[model samples]
Target: MANIEQAATYYEVKKAEDVSRLISKYAGQGKTNKVIWLALIGVFIDAYDLTTLSFGIEQVITEFSLSPVMTGVVASAIICGTIAGNILGGWLTDKIGRYRVFMADMVLFVIAAIVAGLAPNVWVLIIARFIMGISVGIDLPVAMSYLTEFSRFNGRSNKAARLAAWCPMWYAASSVCFAVVLFLYFLLPEEYANWLWRVSLIFGAVPALLIIFIRGKYLTESPIWLANQGNLKEAVKILNESYNIPALTKIEYAQAVQIKPSHTGFAVLFNKTYLPRMIVSIVIHISVAFQYTTIAFFLPSILSRFFHTDTLTTISTTLGLNLLFAFTGGLLGVYIASRLTSRLVLIAGFAIQFLALLSLSLIGQPENSFLLYIAIIMLGLWLFAEGFGPGAQMMIYPTMAYPASIRGVGVGFNRAVSGVAQATALFLLPIWMAKYNTHVFLIISVFAIVPILVIGFLIKFEPTAVDVDAVVENDNIIKNLQHQISSQ
Candidate 1:
């Protein structure tokens, strides 16, 4: 009887320690800076792959002898594929795990890039581009989920900083790609122009390859995920290695075993407690979708229409502006987002975008050089605001609002919605711009204003600069506890 009692006591103590370690790991206090950087590298590659087509579109058209409408269709194809991929990827991330999804997606992107470069006809190019879009679409949600989950172990504020730094790396890569393409075009003969475009397509694969190796070398499964799976021992082990915590024994595990909120599906997002925030998140995403498609995707054509410049000059100028504004805005957005409320940053971004659009609409008539410069500067400011605000806001919202269990789904839903908006805008905006000119900008400006008011005035939650775990715990326990008790 004495021996049996002693064994039973030992088991109980061991179990308790296991639980304690699990909690610590899931709470995100144990991850290293190196883990964060590797994840960011994956995101950088994802961004580069997504933006590469914008620079390659002109060359694609000339090589294929395709019409402007066809070019729009090609661009729209990727966005459409991305929408589908985002939903699938989000589901898969939760189902399969982040590392698996991330690594696989990179391979898909690399394959798509190589195929796109080798395409013999326009249809093949379209197919390849669509596939590439799908891969990036998957990467965005999975990568963001990975970043959010891992960073949470450290702090949400750190996550914001990491995203701010890494997200703009995409724009920087796009700029570099454009410069390289231009140089290659100049260096190579017209007979080899198609080859240069092909080479550019293949270049999209490089970052993915680099990230794949890095991820393979260093990436670990999310500890939060491990806890959710009831694998406390493994979760604790990861925490020890990641955060430099000493090994936890069973006694610690039992003391720390508290049930966290479930975060697995669409239901988590639509739960009564999270519903209003969900609406706010959806609106923010839609607003960004509208703004991004109009400014980033359509700006070149708009310039061409207004300036009556040759295609090369229009593309070159647009690429230059994209590089400048995207980089500046990305960096600025990171800074402001880290310092201010995401809601305020978003409102400010829309306000800036609206003003820039209005200014461009009023002054951007044909052959108006002074107006052109004004438009460029204002647009740059607008992009800057987007980078600091919407870009960062998008990264923050789903992660902040959802618990770990359902975070992937929430982010995936948000990304998928944004992708749909982008696809639709790309398909329809060209026709509208051709018909209405400045009126198109005016219409987009009006849409941008509505969200600013709704988010600024109606929404009550503020997520900026808060402790991520504390916020999640408070939001989950206090707000949700109240919600549960009230519902009963």
Candidate 2:
């Protein structure tokens, strides 16, 4: 009996090894390029739709006779809805699966786009935008989590960054939309102005339609999620199909031991083991959220106020900068993120943004075009820093830090909080910019400072090149070592 039990244990351990080897062998092949591309395209479409409204604001305001306050409310509605969507989508994805949730969200996005385009009044438009926001909001966190989980660590991180890199397509598409709006504005007589804006809103549906086909045909569910659910057979099958490996038998599947789920919750984030990292992530996200809304969404309005450029020029320049310069920032961030720790990159990025904002606040005054130009360039650089640094930081950190069981929830909570911060900033920044002007930069400067302090002093866990799972284990070892040293 003892001999039989010992043989059984040996067989189980060997089986687990064989299964791991088989999975890694296929994962090593890195054949997920096409899937990653399709996912990136999906993200691009979502980003484009979300950002397009910023460009359409002038048109919407003109046609609807909307006050600045009303415009802010309209913009804020989508963001608020997105917060709810993130939580709901995350829960659904964890409960159901990533592919199912993604497909459903795509349909929602398309329907919302139609409603928004056809909205007859401001109230209707606001409701449609809110729904649209929810759809995209759910899409971002889930899509990102799917990409990270499906990707193998070898060059997969870079590929994941590229998935986000395509986010500029959002700005590029918005730029084109701006161009189209400009053309229609000129081509059509004054009587058709309202129709022109409505057309642009309707046109937002194009990306969604394209993505629906792409996602339906190609998107694969996350194998990690499958493994965590104890569906080794399905997980292995996906690996075989995605990475082109030989099929495994039920016997092989039974040999694999179950992976215990990580106990992830909102409360877990505040636990002693995780609190510091959580704080750092929150501060970085908040700073990025605040700056992104102020710069990306509000910059054109601010530029128009300061430069007194024509509507076309303002829109064109805004589109151009976002597509060209902002995209550059995203790429630059990926490159930098590969070279350094996410925390370090985040720290440096925020530090640069702080200086840039301080310089702008000091020199940015009415009638100072030269300083304004400098400020714009610096602002782009600031965006580049965040785009390259904290952007990757947040995406990689949460995905890696949390356990498989609560990974979706952890990401959802982070996104929800970030969304709230962004929504508040989006609604208020414009009003503040119109009213406070220089004081706005001052406020941004203060927010930027918070992350630098958090990273430098408080953050103890640094997962630079470590696998996210390994990072959690290593963090435990570090804690034990610290305790021993202190006691000694």
- Highest lDDT against the true fold, candidate: 1
lDDT of each: 0.69, 0.68
- lDDT string for model 2 (332-433, tens) is 766665556666777787888788788778766646667667877876776666566665566666655665456666677777888899889988887888
Q: List residue ranges in candidate 2 displaced over 4 A.
A: 1-31, 156-190, 246-252, 255-265, 366-369, 469-488
Compared with the true structure, the alpha-carbon lDDT of candidate 2 equals: 0.68
TM-score, candidate number 2: 0.86
Question: Candidate 1, residue 363: CA error in Å?
Answer: 1.3
Clashing pairs in 2: 333-388
How does candidate 1 fare on TM-score?
Answer: 0.86
